[model samples]
Target: MNLSFSKLFFVLAFVFGLFAVMVIAKSVLIPLSMALLVSFILFPVVQKLEAWGVNRLLAAFLSLLMMFLILTGFLTLFSTQIMNFSDQIAGFTGKIMDTLSEVIVYINGNINFIEDLNREELIEEGISWLQASSGTLLQSTFSTTATLFTGIFTTIIFTFLILIYRDGLTKAFVSFGEVENQDRIFRMLQKIQRVGKQYLSGMFILILILGFANSIGLLLIGIDNPFLFGFLAALLSIVPFVGTTIGAVIPVLYAFMSSDSLWVPVAVVIWFWAIQVIESNFLNPKIVGSSLNVNALVAILSLLVGAAVWGVAGMILFLPFASILKVICEEFDQLKPIAMLISNDISGDEKKAAKNSMWIEKVKGWFK
Candidate 1:
C-alpha cells in the first residue's frame, strides 16, 4: 500500500513538473508540437514521393512545397477578406461612435442613480480613451503578428526536418526500450501516427463540409461574404466547444453592424445556431468520432489547462496530446485504469468498478 502511494505521488509530481516545463518553454515547444502534427499529416505524401523514385531530401522538400502552396492560397484568401473587413470598419467608425453616444444618452435618461453623468462629456471622454488606447493596441497587434509569422516559419522548418528524418527518429525511440518491448513501442508509434493523420484529415473534411453547409445557410439569409464567414467559422470550430460560439459571434456581429434590419442579425444568429447543432450532432461524430476518444469533462479540463499554459496554440495542441497520452496509457498494463478514466468508454462495469475502488481508497485514506 505504501509502495502504491509513493508511485501515485511520483506520477502526480511528474505530471505537474511536465506542465510547468511546457508553460515555461512554450515559445519553442508550441512550434515543435505544431510541426510534429504537421509531419504526421505530410508523412504519406513524402512516402508516395519516395516510392516514385524521388530522393529522400527531395521528397521531403516536395511535401513541404505542397503544404506551403496550400497555406499560401489560404492566407491570400484570408488577407483579402480581412482587408475588406478593415475597410468596412474604417468606414463605419463614425457611425459606431454616433450609435455609442445615443446609447449612453438613452441609458443615462433611463437611470436615475447615475444623474451625475453628462452625455456629451461621456462621449468626449470615451473618444479620448479610444484615441489613447489606439497606439498601444496597434503596437500590440504588430508584436503579435510578428510572433505569429515567426512561429509559422519555425514550424515549417521543423516539419521538413521531421519528415526527412522520421525513420531515424523511430529507430532511436525503439533503441531505448527493451528488445522484447521494441515491437510494442513500434506498434504504439504507428497507432499514434495513424491517429494524428486521421484526426487531421477528418478535421479537414469536416471543415469543408461545415463550411459548405454554413455558406448555404448564410447565402439563404442574404448575408454578405457568405463563403468567407462560413469558412472562417468552420476553421475556428477546430478549437472544440468554445470555438463554435466564437466563430458564430463574429459573423452575427458583422450582420448586426452591416444590416439595417434587426431581423437580418437575428436570422444570422439562428442560422449559425442551427449549423452548430448539425456540426455537434452529425458532422463531428461522423468525421472525428472516437479518434481522440477523450471523456468530455477531461477534454474540457485539458483545453482550459492548455489555454492557460500556451494560449491559443495550447488549446489546439492539447487535444492531440491527450490522444497520445491515451495511446500510451493503453500500451502499458499498469496504466490501463488511467486510460479508462480519460477515455470516453465509461459505460463498462469494469470501468465503474475501478472508479469506485479508486474513490473508496481515497475516502479510506482521508482518515489515515
Candidate 2:
C-alpha cells in the first residue's frame, strides 16, 4: 500500500511539473531549450575542428563565426525582399479577396445541389474579423519580437559555453559512474553526439538541396524574386506538413497576380509535388533514415504540443529534443519500453504479432 501510494504521488507530481512547465515555457524554458539545441547542432562542427588540431576555444569561435556570417549574409540578401513582400501584402490580400469572390460566383452558378451557401457574408465576416483583431495582432507581434531577441542572446551565450567546455561536460557525466559504468556513460555520450550531429547535418543538407531546387524551379517558371521565395520555402520546410504548402503558395500567388496565368501556378505546384515526392522517397531515406527514428505521428504531436507551449521556436526545437529523449531512454534497460514507443522501429514480425494479439483479444471478448 505504501509503495502504491508513493507511485501515485510520483505520477501526480510529474503531471503537475509538466503543467508548470507549459505555463511558464516562454519566460523560463524556451531560451534554455533553444540554447541546448543550437549547442547540439554546432557541437559536431567544433569537434571536427578539434580533430583538425585546432584548440577547442579557437575551434568553437571559428565555428560560431561561420554560423554568424552565414546568418548575416542571408539576412542582408533577404531583407529587401522581405520588406517588398511585406509592402505587397495589402495587394495580395485584395487579390485573394477577388479570387475568392470569383470562386464563390463560379460555385454558385455551377454546383446547384440545393445551394444555400452565404459566401458573400462569409467573406465580409472574414475581412471584419481581420480588422477587429489588428491591434491585438500587432501587440502580439511586438511581444514575440522582443522574446525572439532575448532568446537569441541567451542561446548564443549558452552555445559558446557548451562548445568551449564540451569535453569537460562529457568527463563530468562520466565521473558520475563507477569505472565500468564510466565506459558505458562515455559510450552513451558518443552515441548522443553522433546521433545529434547526423540529424543536424542531414537536415542542413536537405534544406540546402530543397532551397536550391526551389530557386531553380521558380526561375524556370518566370517567377519574380525566385531566390527570395525559394529561401522562404526552405526556411518554412523546417516545419513539418505545412512548410511545403506555405512555400508553394507564395510563388503560385505571385504567378497568378503578376502574369495572371493560372497555368504558371499549376506548373509550379506540379514541380513542388515532384520535388517533395523525390525528397521523401529518395533523399530523406538516404540522408536521415534510421538516425532519429521518430515516428511521423509522434513528431507531429510533439510539434503541436511544443507549439502550444512555446510557439514557433518550440516547434523547431521539439523534434531534436524528442530524438535525444528517445536515445536516452534506449540507452537504459529499464526505459526500453518508452524508447520503443518513441521509435519508428516496428519490425514486420512485431506488427504481425500485434495484429494477431488484437484479433485474439477481440475473439475472446466476443465469446465472453
Task: Please write out the lDDT profile of model 2 over residues 41-70, one tens digit for every residue.
Answer: 788788899999999889888988999999
Query: For this target, which candidate reaches the highest TM-score against the unseen true structure?
Result: 1
lDDT of 2 at 281: 82
* Regions more than 4 Å wrong, model 1: 1-5, 113-116, 346-368
lDDT string, candidate 1, 72-188, tens digits: 898787787677877888877666777887887788788855777776787788789989999999999999999999999999899988998899999999898999999999999
lDDT of every model, 2 decimals: 0.86, 0.78
Model 1 earns a TM-score of: 0.91
Model 1 per-residue lDDT at 144: 95
Q: Backbone clash tally for model 1? A: 0
